[model samples]
Target: MPQIPSAEALRHARAALATETETIAKAGGRAPVTDPVITPFVRALRAGGFTIQTSASGCDALGTCPACQNRYLYTALRAGLAHAVCPHCRDAADRKAAVAGAARASAGPCPPDRVGWRGAAIAAPPA
Candidate 1:
């Protein structure tokens, strides 16, 4: 069975294509009809069950979420957030926060002395 490429591998392939596209554009030339290096990546991606669609004007490969393996991931502002986020990871974080909040609410205020910090006065002198 063919091994599925990792997220890093995918990113490297995308970056290489982008660089090639930019270089060609700067020289007043159209994007290459084909890239030797990126062709293999495209093939690997298709083999791993991803659709290959090149951007109209630039080299932007959009397919699959490298993080959670979700198809809905994108680099754009989320609801009430300035930064991008994967919905899968965000939802998981929200659920964890809710559980932690409930646990803290039931536990009441934690004692500061038990928080595991040592004062400088409690340190032993070097021999």
Candidate 2:
């Protein structure tokens, strides 16, 4: 049988949920308190000392980028993105991903003879 939470533990859990709900309300509800994508991103921003200000309708926000210290506006409708992210940082990340992808492509596919070996261990010889 599974152990049930004690009465006191249940009460504490309820209180915590209530507090979280209130916080979400104040933040304009752009993302829920438990949102998989936005919640952790917002938490990381706050931890990095960035302030996020949201509109009353919960569709827009303004925040500063900790990486570049540039202010950026976030709108869910603008680019089909659901979360607020600094454009500069986003661009940097995109460039980094592109470079990594290019590097991987340049490395080429594994030889058919190395089918049993892992990809990392089957690096193509330099041209």
Candidate 3:
């Protein structure tokens, strides 16, 4: 489980990021990452043995979570649903399936009908 950041920690990080962003805008360059507030905040948390890690990439980064609106939703390749969903939503769907019993193969194309006799055999006189 990931450790949730405290309000204070979030505030500090936001301030640091804003300060750095403003500085970069003034300098006409991308933001420099040497914000002083960041180091102190991280060090304070480290002293308490709390690790701060951000969600980097994967499906979470590619799409937004439908439930939380966070970029934590990932693309899931399930049988029926052809959409991206968060892990929680996927589990809920699984539970629903179990309760509903196995799905019948009724949606896909129907199998071909068995071949039938074209017509009654015609008797022919000796050639």
Candidate 4:
């Protein structure tokens, strides 16, 4: 089980949740909140390979629990919500993954006409 989230962490989560909720509502979509609901927007979480624990209120005001980062409403009557990110250093990890991925892709397999010059294939080592 994960520990409770810090106030700062919760603040970050709340901001992110609001951004996503507004974006969804603006699109005229009634997205029922769920653990899977954030899958699309949690790219940072995904890239960092962090597992999230959502609460039963996943479909509520999109509020996030400080303990589990679960989404839920302030109350049954408030439209506002609270959220927090997983404490997995997902942001930094994701950035590293992105940079590493770009480096890997750019250094992909050599062309058919090239030959091994170390890990890199060159022009058949100039014959």
Candidate 5:
């Protein structure tokens, strides 16, 4: 049988999690919790399946990556974003985008007929 944490321990963990959440919110998604006194409690709650709800504007929080299902810290700038990816996954996405962009650029310009109205306007010969 597994040992269960006491009520006092759970309360302390909750408080620690709240404090860290506030710190991250105040820092605008730039600060990570490094307080020696609080980190362990927060980590414990997280490992025990506690979830912290972040603000809609933005926040830095520890979260599980939806894509990889691995726990990681993620920062979101807005509400619409899926803020679950780790740094490694984000870097990989950026690299992939860069490669695709390079491929498109090297594929040469689209034929004149294939160009949209905006493209045609830009490419039109001077009147």
Candidate 6:
């Protein structure tokens, strides 16, 4: 009295189980992502089955995080993965760059609040 899965269903089920296991192993093996980058992606992948999540909500990587504002890539933040800045942040950065370029163009090379604009040390020009 039990029903058996069709061949395709069985294959899919097996692959899903395997992938979930793999995801767990990969997630556990790492130092663990504390970056706000991984939070929602991690939660979705954990709570929803991957295919349903992918098909219904689209891939996790396609979404942006609110806190760190990094494009969340993959279910977990693996070492090899590279993510771009969130689109919202990218727009803001671009706007700032445009304003700075305009200011430099009008005001000449030296700006009054030069240090305010720089967080890192710039290399000195030639002696």
Identify the candidate with maximal lDDT.
5
Query: Which 10 consecutive positions of candidate 5 have the poorest summed lDDT?
Result: 94-103
- Kindly list the per-residue Cα lDDT of model 6 for residues 21-103, writing each as its tens digit: 67877888533334332333233333322211121223332445454555532221112212222322322111121122122
Candidate 4 wrong stretches, greater than 4 Å: 1-3, 34-127
| Stretch of 10 with least lDDT, candidate 3 | 93-102
Q: In model 1, what are the clashing residue pairs, if there are any?
A: none
RMSD of 2: 19.2
Off by over 4 Å in 5: 1-3, 30-42, 45-127
lDDT string for model 4 (19-110, tens) is: 88788899999855744334333433333333232222332123334555544311110011112333332111111111112112212342
Record all residue pairs in model 3 with backbone atoms less than 3 Å apart, i.e. clashing: none
Model 6, position 103: C-alpha lDDT score: 22
Please, what is the TM-score per model?
A: 0.27, 0.24, 0.30, 0.27, 0.24, 0.21
Q: Best-fitting candidate, measured by TM-score?
A: 3
Kindly list the per-residue Cα lDDT of model 2 for residues 1-127, writing each as its tens digit: 1112223443454555567878888988853436433344444443333333333342324556557787652311111112335534542111111111221221234232221101122234567
Whichever of 1 and 2 has more TM-score, that candidate is: 1
Error of 1 at 83 (Å): 36
Off by over 4 Å in 6: 1-3, 29-127
**Which digits, one per residue and each the tens of the lDDT, describe model 3 over residues 1-127?**
2222344654666675677789889989976565353344443343433322211221112345556665534322223222233433322112111111012112132112111111112233345
TM-score, cand. 3: 0.30
lDDT of each: 0.35, 0.35, 0.34, 0.32, 0.36, 0.30
Name the better of 1 and 4 by TM-score: 1
Pull out the clashing pairs in model 2.
none
Deviation of model 4 at 126, angstroms: 57
lDDT of 6 at 122: 30
lDDT of 6: 0.30
